[model samples]
Target: MLAFLYPGLGHVYLREWLRALVWFFLNVTSFTLLMPADAVPETFGWSELVAAAENVTPEAALALAAITVFSMIDAYWMAKRQNTETEVEEGTTCPNCGRDVDSDLEFCHWCTERLNPESDEAEETADDSGANA
Candidate 1:
């Protein structure tokens, strides 16, 4: 939505400073290179803007529109990805060190504690069965 107004505004909302700047500069450069000199207005007004827009060549309009649309889509996807990442549970706590650790490993990465979850479950099951026998 914000990107519909300009290419970099959506990136700014996403807190991507670098991308925002890049997109902003790209928009300025495109306008500088593609916009007709006669289209530049000395005064600022809604009517002046409309008149200027009328002078934009079809090719330039297409390019600028494409950039804005792409920027909006990119920002939308990034926001969606951020939301998904935050919603998902991540990693595990190391029991020994009480620190965050990767869940893929069988040991606490920080304290080198054995946290072989599968083996521990198996052992517990075996112990319970044996005790019942």
Candidate 2:
């Protein structure tokens, strides 16, 4: 995915604006700080880093690009893992009684009507063995 090749894009796809902003800020800041200080003349904060990268040997450029690409991949993996856990949590809540239920439950454990009824059968089912005793 193109999102995995560019940092913060995956968060944007997930609609997490604050996370995207933080990821972009942190990556840019760290990249700026890690470049060799005297390798390039400073202009703006970012211009110095861009100049340093451009002036570097081809191997250095490749290494920096690889690092950036891996960071984006890490962000995408983290977002997907978080989204999956959230979906699982959302699906397991009981709608009728607001109780936590297993994902496979057909009816709320506290209220034993089908999740949806046909309207012909009574909502409540009586236990007849207790009555016979």
**Which residue pairs show backbone clashes in model 1?**
none
> Residue by residue across 1-133, what tens digits does model 2's lDDT show?
5444566677787777886777677667655765555556666678776776576666555555765676577667777787787774675766677777776767778876455444324433333444666
Q: What's the C-alpha lDDT at position 87 in model 2?
A: 70
TM-scores for the candidates: 0.62, 0.42
What is candidate 1's lDDT per residue for 1-109, written digit by digit as tens?
Answer: 8888889898899898998998899889998998898688779999998898788899998888888888899889888988887753544777677787777888987
Write down the worst ten-residue block by lDDT for model 2.
118-127
Clashing pairs in 2: none
Model 2 bad stretches (over 4 Å) = 1-38, 45-54, 88-114, 118-123, 127-133
